[model samples]
Target: MDRLARRLGLRTDPHIFFWSAGLMVVFLVLLLSFQQPIGDAFGAGREWITTNLGWFFILGVTSWLVFLIWVATSRYGNLRLGKDGDRPAYSNLSWFAMLFAGGIGTVLMFWGVAEPISHFASPPFAGVEPYSVEASQDAMGISLYHLGLHTWAIFTLPGLAFGYFIYRYDLPMRVSSVFYPFLKEKIHGPIGKTIDVFAVLGTLFGVAVSLGLGTSQINAGLTALTGVPDAVWPKVLIITTLTAVATASIVAGLDKGVRRLSNLNILMAVGLMLFVLIAGDTVFLLRQLIESIGIYAGDIVPLSFWNDSMAQFTDEGGWGWQAGWTVFYWAWTVTWAPFMGVFLARISRGRTIRQFVGGVLVAPAAFTLVWFVVFGWSAMEIDGIGGSGGPISAAVADSVPLAMFAFFDQFPAATLVSGIAVVVVALFFATSSDSASLVVDMLCSGDGEAGPVRQRVFWGLSEGLLAASLIVLGGEAGLAALQEVITVIGLPIFLLVFAMMFALIVGLRRERVPKPVEAPARHQTAEPRPAQESPPRAGSQT
Candidate 1:
């Protein structure tokens, strides 16, 4: 295996590289060879996880949020992620841009208008009248709940662990290294390798979900603009084209490719958002933004713990909705945790724990909230509360990919704005794919450095292939398959995240408490406290 790798010019951990790639290949084969059975299996898996462990998902993610908050406020917050004199690799603006772009740029674009409006049309709360003002508030708040601090908390914990261990302790840049305190030397053994293998699988499926969504949305944009048909072939073509673009980016490496594209994503996103705010009801959106923040804050506590236990009796489909939306989201985010965690840690060197936690938790989330309000509330207003048979709502129910474009159609310069939205989604797609590929490369290489171009290109293309295959599996069913697979895969990764939290706590405690230096006893003092250098009295001058 080593000789084969060497011959291929691939500098990689044979265990991780071969196993992860092989497993993915087998999965693809199974998916394509017997699409129905594979899809059914994924569906069953999703159902089982959501049914049995839905509350666990809720409680686990909420715990991470609480844990991160405590860590940021605790004494451990002062510890720097790197050496004492080390500073951030990127400036605050660039760092934040990369953070937002890498973390959830594609998802925000895909779901910004869709999710809030969906919630407004069908309020999660039983008594809340759909499309009412309360429903609108609930919609925005729920959107915030899904995309806000909880989501970033999941990313922050693993990122904090990776950064501290890799930079401070000089451990290898692998998910298993986060367990160095517990695994000790065994982090090099099968146990550690298995952890990394799961990390790779989770990352693959997680990023595939984003790639699939981006591709679908891109196809939707093209379909709307050019009268192209939205079908399997276009999505496959979109995935192929974007994957090639991502491969080039990965080959260019992080700073040259991913960073530049990420910055562009932020600029485009902000510009588009500002256009909506200014062109639309600017004052209403501003007011809604403030109110949504308050609504989110007030409801965050109950929403975090709401498992919809009673829905089984009263509302037959309520639990299903929770499972489909909240549980699926938590699971999906958990799958991305390793990818985002590694990416976050890679970019977050030289930051203090408090800074890393606070920035990660707040910055992207704030942007996400503002985005939902600007786009989501705008869509709701245009649709008149409960949609009232509006085109945007129809697109959302019929095809989520078309929802944003449908909303933009209501504004002036719809063509131009829709075109820019497509560019934003495409850039976000490219950034996400390349970022995941880079992270996977790091995981496979064992040392976190860029490997051979062949390796990078291979992972980047593999992500596209997997995404395309899922789309081909059954189109919409393929997309649901992506969600189901992530939800199932997320169970173990979610548990792994908790273990990471424990390991981080132990490591942080050690860092927080300085080791005591042994002083020579009075009877055995060799050179302690010479008479001429005796300590000064409390009140005496030197």
Candidate 2:
């Protein structure tokens, strides 16, 4: 049997491809056959889970924090990324792209338009006074909570676990690496190959979902602003266009294309915000910002654990949709974690775990919340005092950028907001495509940039191709199916994330070194590493 398996080239790296495909098929079949029953069951289950597992996530967050602290204070903090602790793998732009792509930048594009309005319509707590009032401060709170620390913690665990074990421990850089420490020695064989297969499938499903969502939103925005039809063809066309661009950038390697695109995207996002602050509702917007921040801080916990209780918020006909949003976001982040984490870990040598968790996880969350505050707050002001909510609301469920256009064109600033929107979308899509292509290349080749330029280009085109296929399939259902697969396959890795946290903590404590020993007779000591994650060198950050 072993001889035959080897001859057939059967794998040993947690070959989960068949399993992921089966699991996703099962999920979809169940979705089609027992969706109502499953939704009802899962809906209640999530509420119960939230009520019971509030601490589950909190525990996850806390443990991750401790592990980070340990790394900062240990010999591990002195480590860098090269083969023998040489230096970083890529330039600043390339590293950031890898992180941002997996970090949910596309969601930022989606949420900038949809989230504020979502909270405005129905915040987490009914008792809050702002429930029905347009531009309720509570709404912004929910939006922030959705984009808050816990969400990143939930999502980042798998990535960190996968990266440390795979990249750090010299295990194969696959999602299956998370389960390696637990699998004993057998994980290096066929069973491990099966697991890796599932992980790859999981990543594909997740990326497919992202591509579909991104294309839809982009298509919707283009349709609203331009006279293009919001149909299957346009979405398909956009996907094709994006994939072509991604292929070219990936081929150009990280130094040239990926970094250039990401920096451009970040700059555009800043410029768009600046335009709103400069030309949109200045006074009302300032007031909205304060209220939104307060609402976010106060209600974050509840929003993070919200379960619809069979109550879909009125807009979707039940709070279940909100539940879907939470669950889906968590899974998407987890699914993308491995690729992003590896990419981050690859670039982040010479830095402490504290820095990685803090900068990558914490800082990004802060930036995202701020972005929400600016865009959502501005939209809320328009909704409350002006009739901006009508256009925003009408477009919210469809495309976020379109919704923003409606809100921004409120009075005298129509053309200015429109111009900003154009700039943001252009950079936004480029960032996503470039990062995604790089990630796909990593999976296809051992290194992120190892493939020949043309090879990377082929993979780059694949991203757009699958997205176009999804568009041809039609409707939100197609997109939802793709997302569901990512979430389902992403489920097992969550446990692996917890396990990695535990392992890192244990490893750190066992090997922890003290600063210096002081005695009465003689105060002699050797220099010690700092008790925090080390900062990256000048070149790495750049």
Q: Tens digit of lDDT per residue, candidate 1, span 1-542?
A: 67777777788888789899999999999989998887788888888888788999999999999999999887667667777667798999989988888889999999999998888887878888877887888888889999998888888889998988777776678898888778777777788889999899889988988888889899999999998899999899999999999999999999989999999989999999999999999999989878888998998999999998876787653356788899989998888888898899999998988999989998888888888889989998988874454778788888878899999999999999999999999999999999999999888776666788898899999999998987888665545767787888889999999999999877766553322344212122121121232322211000
In Å, residue 334's CA in model 2 sits off its true spot by 1.9
List the global CA lDDT of all models.
0.85, 0.56
Leading candidate by lDDT: 1
Decoy 1 TM-score against native? 0.93
Per-model TM-score on C-alpha atoms: 0.93, 0.75
The local lDDT score (0 to 100) that residue 424 gets in candidate 2 is 59
CA deviation > 4 Å runs, candidate 2: 1-98, 127-135, 166-168, 178-180, 184-187, 283-294, 302-321, 385-389, 397-401, 411-423, 474-486, 493-496, 506-512, 515-542
